[model samples]
Target: MAVLTSWVWLLAGCLSAAVAEDSNVSALYPPLWEESPEQISDYRLEDGKHIMDPWVITDRMGMYRILLKQTAPYFASYAPENEQNILWGLPLQFGWQYTTGRLADPTGMTDCGYEAGDTLCVSVDSWWADVNYYLSVLPFLAAVDSGILGIPSDQISILPPLKDQMMFCYTVSGCQSAFPEAMGRWSAFFQYMQSPSSDFDGLLEYLWAAHTSSLEYPTRAFVDRYAYYSDQEANFEKNWAIAVDYIAATRLPTTLSRVHSFQNGLPPRVLVDTDIAPYIADFTPLQNKVLVLLNVLGNIHHFTGSLFLTAWESAMSTKAARKLFLISFEKFLETSS
Candidate 1:
């Protein structure tokens, strides 16, 4: 079965908080002003940047094949003139680092809430790390292919014809596809599966007019090239570096100053790839206690909001103070081993 990692923010395209629209933070750290609080259309962050525009895609099979365009940034554009070798915009600093020097990884860091195991390094920051997660939705796949890709509960074989029709130059004119034909061909494969009776055709007609696939950095190459400075690997280094130093010096969990981060770790580390067994033990007891308490409260129905908040806070404690995640990792089976 295809995995559909649906997120609350996917549908929360509108923003309710005025704070998001007016926040001076656009200078950039985290996007506290998420679309959830407001309609993304009202505050299209990528408006003229063209590169970040949300509507620049080509539909293939049941997927949106995104291509670069002249209006988009030179780095991500597929246009021959704007074609960047890397997927996303590569920063100049990492380019210099790759050519001019090699920075040594911290050989040792043993601290609660942080661990750099073997050659692989790991870091722990507060919710600041959540940005590492991507924003891919099945809806994206479905819209590109007339909602056929939205079927996550069943096994569907790859349709060869759809793939064949997908490869080509991307433009509003040529990029527009005959998703109706594709949808009709797929309808017979599943009884429960329903294709729109030309309603989706009209929707596709509308959707096909504007391309919408520039919201994310699509490839590892893009991340590697553009994120060299703050790549997850490097951020892991930074967070772990701070964590280790803080723990080693304080011999305890403490709120770390952000300034101490990432000096040695150029690219942030990727914990998603970490072996859970090696580091799961580092999760602190405080987090476990909170999660356990939340579980106790979850038995009741009314104080539910508190239960959710407790769970959320407990999960967010990836800082130097929680081993509650040992259970979390085991529950999620995120352990590398």
Candidate 2:
């Protein structure tokens, strides 16, 4: 009986030790299962619907926050001063040092919020670093496309016009080049809607035209290279249809008519004070639909970037080319917003 009692005490002590160890681990790497009140307050999620900013919203969602925290220890383990260097800044600087045979200080490279000691700022800085790096690579990509990578002019013909298409797709002012027919149709529809004699039948016709142009047969020619990802392609079509339906079902014409009326004679201050809020409220659903469509389009952009990277990798077969492709892909993911 005494021996049994000893065994029981030993087991309990072991369990206590294990629990204490787990508590330490939890302190070292906190899980983000529940957001703290401070985080909620800082991010302004008290109302549940209003987001203070993109970063705050992303933080509230715990998007990459826990991952950054959990990985902090590993990052700190290798830094010279045990600095919080979360973005592999130490290693990157060391790599540059080794390559150039000179000690490189990455302090300036760290952005406003990140200074190698703040874990959260490190993660955010790393993200923006990648964004800036990718943006900076666009000119290099353009140069490569113009024959810097040594691809014969003849071989260039086989490559898709990825850069051109990307620019056309992203540039709001250049939309006419990408979808001339749709732009022309929408222009005529808007002109008619703005006229004094505009009626319900004309609105219905405009809706039909928008549906046909935007949904039934979109500007596929611009994105023809992406036929490989059939699933994404299908989603693109479906999301676009939803967007068109949302627009058609909304009080878009009425809102536009009000705008035209305001433009014609209404006092600007009166229009701003009275009409703007209702116009925005009326288009809120359409705005939500646009946000959804933007997400879908972002996915499409990622896939297209992957396709372009693959093509570039295949054609150039060089380390520089691979790096360029990676940069281009990162740019696509960042800018697709």
Candidate 3:
């Protein structure tokens, strides 16, 4: 069975309340966002080929960092300091998953992602890591196909995770064959990236198309994986999945800084039954409410399908309006329920 992972995210790629900065926040980014070598010189050479292993969080993140560094020139005309590089969203989201322990083995039967075991290990047992593979490897291989990596496709080899090794494609041709739609969409993004006519909005459109496709395809495959997670976590995953469609429709910038900022409004770790809005002192009231609303929306039988996008776009088109709507929504839920 070619299964999937139950990755979760909420309020990403959209407007959200302000984030509370952590005291040890710098400790949260992936292992080497700042120091990871951007060039090919650092990769292990095997039989004259650069070996890439993404099963571990650090190495997987390194690929995105390297891609961002390599693609910086293409985006310089749009924004400064690689801020506009569409690839930034990939690593930033992955970093959050790492800090929040989403990349760890959720089952508790294994220490795959624990500091006491292999801290960098991205467990196959983790739904977040599994879904992330599509986001990571597909875009990565597409980058190589688009010639953004500046390396021959055959010159590099990607090592698979410890388990579910057969589920993913390792080479450019393999990925293209297995996931043509996502690979093609991502290839278009990179191609447009190098085009002289490329603009920020256009790049974002392409990026989001590919981003949502990557997410949507694996969701059905991983429906069975939800059994391993807590109800709160599973609900959050479904809610996050639903929310991304609306965000993609809006074509949000999805830059590194913007995503990093928006993600702070989300819960940093797996949600437990005890964690509830206005009751959890660690998170702001707004964050708590946002979390609560996501669960409500995800769990509500009446809120099925993609119908909300029409209303969401018409009524909450502006950031202030969306924020106000979400803030007011909790009250509505209170009154109605």
Q: Whose TM-score is greatest here?
A: 3
Better of 2 and 3 by TM-score: 3
Ten contiguous residues minimizing lDDT sum, candidate 3: 1-10
What's the lDDT for residue 243 in model 2?
33
Best to worst by lDDT, what's the order? 3, 2, 1
Best by lDDT: 3
Ten residues in a row with the worst lDDT in model 1? 10-19
- Model 3 lDDT per residue over 1-337, tens place: 0110001123321244223333453443444587555666678889988888888776788788778888889988766566667677788888888888888888888888898998888888778888898999899889987887888888888998777787778999998888888999999988988888988767877998999889866776777667778887887777877767666755666665556666766787777767766577877655676677666555542454545555555544565554554454344434433
lDDT (Cα, 0-100) at 287 in candidate 1: 25
Ordered from best to worst TM-score, the candidate numbers read: 3, 2, 1
* Candidate 2 residue spans exceeding 4 A from truth: 1-173, 215-337
lDDT of 2 by residue, 53-155 (tens): 2122223223223223333343343333222322222122212222321111123443323324332232222212222221112211222233323333222
Give the Å error, residue 61, model 1.
23
> How many residue pairs clash in each candidate at the backbone level?
32, 0, 1
- Clashing pairs for predicted structure model 2, backbone only: none
Score candidate 3 by lDDT. Answer: 0.72
In Å, residue 238's CA in model 1 sits off its true spot by: 15
Clashes of 2: 0
